[model samples]
Target: MNYDIFNGDADGIISLLQLRLANPVESKLVTGVKRDIGLLGKLTEKVGLSKTDKITVLDISMEKNQTGLVKVLDAGVDVFYADHHRAGEIPTSKHLDAHIDLDADTCTALIIDKLLDGQFHYWAITAAYGDNLIAKGDKLSNLAGLSVELSEQLKELGTLINYNGYGAIVEDLHFHPAVLYTALLKYASPFDVIADNSSPFYRLQNAYQEDMASALAIKPDHQSDKLSIFELPNEPWARRISGVYGNQLANQNPKSAHAVLTENRDGTYTVSLRAPLSNKQGAGDICSQFETGGGRAAAAGINALSKEQIGDFIKAVEAFY
Candidate 1:
């Protein structure tokens, strides 16, 4: 048995799409929600790798999944990992091959496409757009045969799908991202998703638009010259829409950094930060002040914050700006 382990988001799906196109492997897909990574162990349980069984781990990292990865390699599985996450202390297993670049500009999907000489460039662009690599997506879009208008629409789909995968759980989203990925898995190009009338990708796109409209009903927290923080209550709609809301706020008002927080079901919160595209990038620094997260200049996330720290995060953002 062969396995394709992925992150269950745009990058992961598109990464697998690119690899499958190049290698044409009919492997079993092992994926879950965005947070359900470290999949190598799960695959190990399914098929304790013989010399014939193989695994492709996409958009997940040795850093985040070190323990699980070690278990899989120790079990004699042949695993290939492609990721863009920060990694440390490279493993010495002969059965493991890694393609990890923490470059903010290139995601895993794009990396695999590059490895395959861009055989499936459209999916690469979709993954880039979904990851909110806006400038990179624009360039990739131009190369992928999208007219300007269609390119923007596909970008919307990517952003929407990425945004929905956010939230603490599936109940927070209009649709589970696993379901969305199932809808998208058959297509080689995102355009194929839009072009196929029978495809549910368009339906997912429409649902996201409606949900984004609902999330935007709230106003900015404080619209300073440098930052805009939008707070979302612990509601399903708000959680479904937080990531897109953050990106929308950042894109529509590029001069200001944006923080979009969704209060979680447990009364904590998850934050999506899209810092100003300018030079004053302090997102990772601020997020590291708490126990929750660390990310790049333009985009980042904080997984969970205690109720008390919620106030501190708000106060810290003021200092960050």
Candidate 2:
């Protein structure tokens, strides 16, 4: 059996594309939403333990899936693991062929594309843009001869796909990410899909842009040099647009830190924190002060913050900056 598994976001899709371009084959594909990075263990547990079985894993790094990776490789399964995430300590092995790089400027998709000798540079460009590595994105874009407008379109699509994966459950999203991935599977680029006007990507793009407009209007309650806290009132669009709202805020206020608080269905709030992208340190630490949140130093997330404690959280965030 040959298995193809990926992250289920733009990066994952692009990584899979690069692999297919380089070594096209018919394989059993295992995938889920962007948050399903830890699903590798379940796959290993269920799949038959056969030495001849083969697997290709991308985007999600070995460090993130250490135990499961070890189990599958120990079974004598031939595996190719390619990823770009913070890996503290990667195990050394022979069955497991690992291609891992944790550079903020490079994502897994681009890594695979490079490994494949730029067979899927266009897709790699989109994945890099989606991961917010514009310099890398442009490098691939220039090499692929992609138009500026087309690059922006893919960037838009990538951001939308990434944002849709934010909520704790699929129910919180405007569309299930699995369904969205399926819709995108047939198309090579977002520009090709949206160019026709009647395509589903166009409709989704319009909906996402409108929701973004609504979400961006709210003013931050406490704005300072180091921090800004923008609160979203209880509403469907607000919840749906929370991540994009955070991205937009982070862009406009590039030098300052931002905390995006969206009221949950239960009356509490979910917070997304981004320290200055230029100085992305300690953001994950600051968000960990709250419950259910951890990320890199520049960006972090919190599942639920009590409505009453909103003020105190803002104070801590300001102090952290």
Candidate 3:
């Protein structure tokens, strides 16, 4: 069996999309909500591995999935992995092929674009936009000779696809990432999706506008010279929009770190932390202080943070910058 496992966000989805478009294949799609990085283990638990099984993993942290990766390799499975997150120590095994880059401006899709020599260049640019690497996306778009209007269309498409991945669970999302991916696979090009009136692009665009409006109406729960914090209710829309809202906040105030905390039903919080855009450093370090926290330097997250530690989290971000 062939397994195609990826992050549910734009980078992961688009990364896999480009590869599959370049070389169409038959594989079992494995993905989840944006925060579900521990996916390899889930696959291992549900489907016992075999010596001939082939796996492709994208966008998730190799460090977090190392255990499952080792297990699969031990079982003689072949694996291909690519990502831009912090990889503690890569395993040396003939069965594994890994591509990882820690550059702040690069994403998995961009990495795959380099590998494919820009065969699906526009999709990679869209993924960069969705991942909030705004400057990188714009530069790539310009180099591709895309007009300003077309660039905006790709930007919106990328942003909407990215926003769809933020939910706490599949139920919280407008469309499951798997369904979205399958629907997107029909289009040979990103522009084709935009041209088709029945495409998911329209549905996601409308949903994003409604959710973002609600988020914009709220005042920051905490604000200081170096940091700003916003608390969102426990609704599905809040869970779906938290990450993008944090990105918006970071872009709005490039010098100040921002936190978007969505209340969980269990009296905890789901935290999305973005370091200052002006100094994209220390966010991963600060988030790592919590047991449920981990991410890249510019953007990190805490899966479920206790209410009592909210103040401590703010202090850490404030002190870091």
**In lDDT terms, which candidate is top?**
3
Query: Candidate 1 on 117-161: residue-level lDDT in tens?
Result: 878777788788888778889997787667999888778767766
Q: Give one clash count per candidate, in the order shown.
A: 0, 0, 0
Model 3 scores a C-alpha lDDT of: 0.93
Better of 2 and 3 by TM-score: 3
- Write out the backbone clash pairs for model 2: none
Per-model lDDT:
0.74, 0.71, 0.93
TM-score of each: 0.87, 0.81, 0.99
Off by over 4 Å in 1: 41-52, 143-145, 171-179, 280-289, 294-297, 314-321
lDDT of 2 by residue, 1-321 (tens): 888888766688668776765666877777664546676786877877588788888877455578888888777788898876655577677887888775556778888877877765666777777666655676767666777877777777667666666554666665665466556656665566666676556666777888878876787787889888888877766766776577677777778988888887787887878777677677756776776555545566677788788777778778877
| Best prediction by TM-score | 3
RMSD of each predicted structure = 2.7, 3.3, 0.8
Window of ten residues with lowest summed lDDT in model 3: 280-289
What is the C-alpha lDDT profile of model 3 across 133-169, one tens digit per residue? 9888999899999998999999989999999999888
lDDT of 1: 0.74
Clashing residue pairs, candidate 3?
none
